[model samples]
Target: MPGHGSNTESMETASAIVSLITASVAIWKTIDAAICSIKNAPARIQHWRAINRLLQTSLSRMEETMKRRKGAGLSISERKHYESIREHLQCFKDDLEDLQHKIASVALPRRFGKRTIPRQVLTALEIKLQEDPHLEKRVDRNIQLFQLSVALLSLLDPAPRTSVRPILTELHALHLQVSDDDDKLRKWKESAHDIAKDAAMREIGFTSSATDRVRVGRQPSINIQPTPQRDFGIDENFNKEELLHKIKVTQDLATRLEEAGMPTIASNFQLDAIKCGEQLREMHDHPLDMAEYVSLEERYILILISCQSYEEASFQIALNRLNDLASKVDDTSRNELFRERQTIGTLYAKLQDINSAIHFLRIALFDGYLKQQDLLAYDAEIRQTSRLLYEVYECSGMWPDLEVTKKRVRDEFGEDPVASSVEISKALGWCEKKGFTVSERDRQLYFNPLTNENGRTSLHEAALDPKMDMDVLRYLMLPEYYSLRDDSGDTALLLAADRSNYNVVEMLLTIPYLVHVRDRIRRQTPLHRCKDKRTLDLLIEAATRRNSIPPGTDWEPVDINSADCSQRTALHLACQQGRVDLVETLVAHNANVNATCLTGETPLVLACWAADTAKPALEAIVRELVSHGATWEQKFPVRRDPRKRLKARGFSNSDISELTRQPGSSTESSEVEKDASILMHLDS
Candidate 1:
């Protein structure tokens, strides 16, 4: 028993020893594992701390620079710096993330006891080295240490219970500040780009105002500058001239382009410019000399006078400039200046600026005569201009100027010394002093048989004038000039008769000798020439006087119904003119109404011809003709046999009707035989 007991005790002691050894080994392994974890914890925590510090530093620098740059107003250079910083910050963040990943993959397993540490003491020593900086009284280092400690504690199975929430909240706040600063920087950079583009646009003369840019839908706008070739000169006068020249050049270019078969897009503007230049030139060269410069000035005035609207505006401005220049010219240059003034006045007249034109003309006239001491030559154009000025001034109620112009005209031409309101007898006396002669025959002027451009006597012009004065007519109708004829063989009587001049007609009748005169048309007497009531009455009175001859008078009654060419008598003309009164008067005087013309048309046929006449007159004439036994029937001439009545029926034997039945036949015959007999009888 003792041996057994001893054996059991030995077994128990052995068992206890084994258990103690096992427990010690276990404790050793556990301590070793804890030490390993603590060792690896420093490296892991150090890596996390470095990564967090790097990330925080990068974000802090970025945020601060971004804020500073935004406050400073970012320029292009500053924006580039911000972009660099952003790239660097992104790279730093990427590196930090890489480091975190490396720490997690390589160190976390070993520190958590899943693997063995490759270098325990080195990692611990590194953590100790990092701790010294924290311990050196640096706030950032201290923060890093705090963060590292917290990170390591989090990895521990029994982590420290102390709250890390406050630290996390601070980090979050920093992140938010950085984010806001980045946003501000981005906005600043964009604005700077826009401003730079606008400046560029302004430099190009592209009207880069904000409103205009917006209107054009420009974004990130760049300014467009005008090309040097397109730049117009700065001087207003020069610009106008340049524009004119450019237009002219453009027109020429356009013409060339058209010749070349190129499009005329650019040349059209050139043409407009050329026209403007021409107008400006014209306006610049105003009043021209009539004697030495009429032809050129006339053309210039014509061009200027034809302009319309805005084109005319330039012309007006040029004219004003010319006038202004003229006003400043010295008086010694008055003669030369007067020429210019005359030209200007002429232009103004053409432009319908009558008052201004007249004003200049009067000044010119006065300068030519009074001041310049030169006799102003009488010219048709000058007289015409002066006359127009007078009329225009008169209509505008500028009577003083009108009178002045009229006096100038009279002085230049021959002045009429007779009083304007003189009596006819007094005027005649004045005319006698002027060597004017009067005739008791046709009341017309007797001159030296002066011929006009067409070789017509001057009296022809007077006769052609519808408003010719009776006194002039009387003065022209003297016996010595009664034989005068125009180029058209029109005598004074023919003219007076043609114009239906009643007063002239009566005055002409006073000359009994002219009553027997005829024109070149041959035998066309004044009585034969009457077409109207006034001339016809005069002719009738003359005829009656001739018919009621005085005692022992040698005068014989003239035939009033005498015919001329076409065998038309005075009665035919009267009827044709629808003159009922003249016709009745002539008919009462035993005038022949049935007189046939050369065309075989009687007065009755002429009266009924196509014209508007009084129905009563036509009826009376017809009745009188009928009462005179005039027949309406027309008898055809017998060109065939005179003894045979069948010739009047216009049929021969061959032309007889082929019908067997003849309802209106006067004689009976067999059908075929009757037809042949009728044909033969008709032929006979």
Candidate 2:
């Protein structure tokens, strides 16, 4: 039994030994796993540190390069350097991605139950990256990326308290740098704006010169300085006082001399009066009322005597002076002074100083002191004055001033002053009115006021009379009245042309705005109205003055080829007038010598029908017309009766064939001949 018991115990001890060895092997594996996990922690941390270092270096280089780029002007070489740096940063980014992939692929420690790397290790890497100067410089930009994996890991594991504070501190530092840089950049931009504005102001001719000061946001200032006074034979201040005293003494002596009426002293008085008058005349010329009333009276007296001079120019000067003095006088004194002023003005008008006459008359007309009856009593005188003024205005071509005087007279008198007349000899021995007249003399209208019908004034019968005075027409052509059309829709230009008044036509055509005016028909232009050669020549002169003409106007002569109502051109009329020279002139102007009348008759046909005595003229015109491409059919052939048809010429077959070929004519040759014959008879 003991032996058996020994065997059982030996077996049990062996089994126990086997179980202990197995437990020993299992513990060895557990220690090995714990050691392996601990060993991988530092290695993994080192890899994270390397990644952090790489990221920090890359970001720092990028930030530094950007700052350098902003502060310094970059050359091509520097830009190339930056490109290389950007490539390096991209490589760094790849490296980081690779590191992340590698870290993600790492097997979690078995003891940690499939969790990733510890949050503490990731936090350590992020905190180290934040402390790195490179990453610190761009913390705000890099922080989110830096913390991405780490923060995710932290959700799985607790984050390190030490790492969080440092990350926030680094982030704050980066924000402050970005803000400071932004503020500096903003200030620089503001300064640049101010500089640009100032440069713009300087370029626009706004300069700072004393004489031409540029006052911004203020009223313009003017600099005024007193004229320097010169001493005349006395101390400066003392001379002024002494001069005043002497003037007072002279005045007292003059008064005594005037009251005593002494013969010996009278010469001194006269001499003093002459001196005062001369000074007064000087004042009148300048029209300075700064002098006292006594000085003005002396000036008026001087003006009166000067006006009395027989010299035309001297009298004009004196008359102007009197007018100026009258303008300065008060209303109460105007009527009392009217006679003297009127005398001066009337003399001025006689001297051809119409400007002065008009000036004085305007004042008198508007003056309240003059009664309407008194003005009416002087109506003849006023009309005479206006006539003289109109004559002067006509001569001087001062239409604007003339219009002003006319308007003033119309406003005050409600009538044209030039139209009034005085009775002359009675008609046939009957009484007639005396005024400016348009009369006929030597087969031409003359502007002699002494004649019968020719002496009619323009205003008296301008609208009613057909024959106008040449001078009156010239006056009407003045700018003030050039646009005035008479009752017949005839302006001064048209009237002058109709009258064959060459001088009047010449004057009318000189007006700038009258050149293109058409008559009531809207067809007869001023150029179209001329009838006589002299009048036509005047039109040519006016047209040449400004070189103004329609695109194809022919000024060689009155183009009788020019057509009017009834298709009668100037050439047709010239032919009818038997004006052969005028016809030649018209032909030279490229006038359509073949131009047809409404009935299709040419100027040649008209001349042919007019008279056999005009046969030579008719032949010349026909030859010119044919040379200018006039159709032969425009003339007629001999008729059957030969005498009766001589007056009513017939057409030939050749003429019929030519007429058949003309535009819009497709009839048979016999029908064309019949039509041509009909047209010819209608023209005749």
Clashes of each: 17, 17
Q: Give the TM-score of candidate 2.
A: 0.27
Q: Assess the local accuracy of residue 309 in candidate 2 as a C-alpha lDDT between 0 and 100.
A: 15
Query: For candidate 2, lDDT tens digit of each residue in 1-684?
Result: 323432333233333323333443343343223333333455434433323323333233334324322322222222222233333334334434433443345454467555634543344344445545343233223322222212111111111212121122222222333443544333322332222222222222232211112123211111113244565533223333443454445444444432332212222333444344334435434322323433534433343332221112334454555555545553335444444455545544444455776555444444431345667787766665566555556545677876786777666776666542221111111112334444432222344443235433343234233444533433333233445455555555666666666665554544423444455653465555666766665554343232223333222222223355677776776666667656654554335555777766666666556554254565555444433334444344433121232234343555434333312122323232233232222212
Local distance difference test, per candidate?
0.42, 0.40
| Superposed model 2: Cα runs more than 4 Å off | 1-474, 478-480, 512-529, 541-562, 627-629, 633-684
lDDT of 1 by residue, 533-624 (tens): 65775765455432222334222344577666667777777777667766654554446645777667666566655246665565454444
RMSD in angstroms between candidate 1 and the native structure over all alpha carbons: 50.2
Cα RMSD of all models vs. native, in order, equals 50.2, 42.6
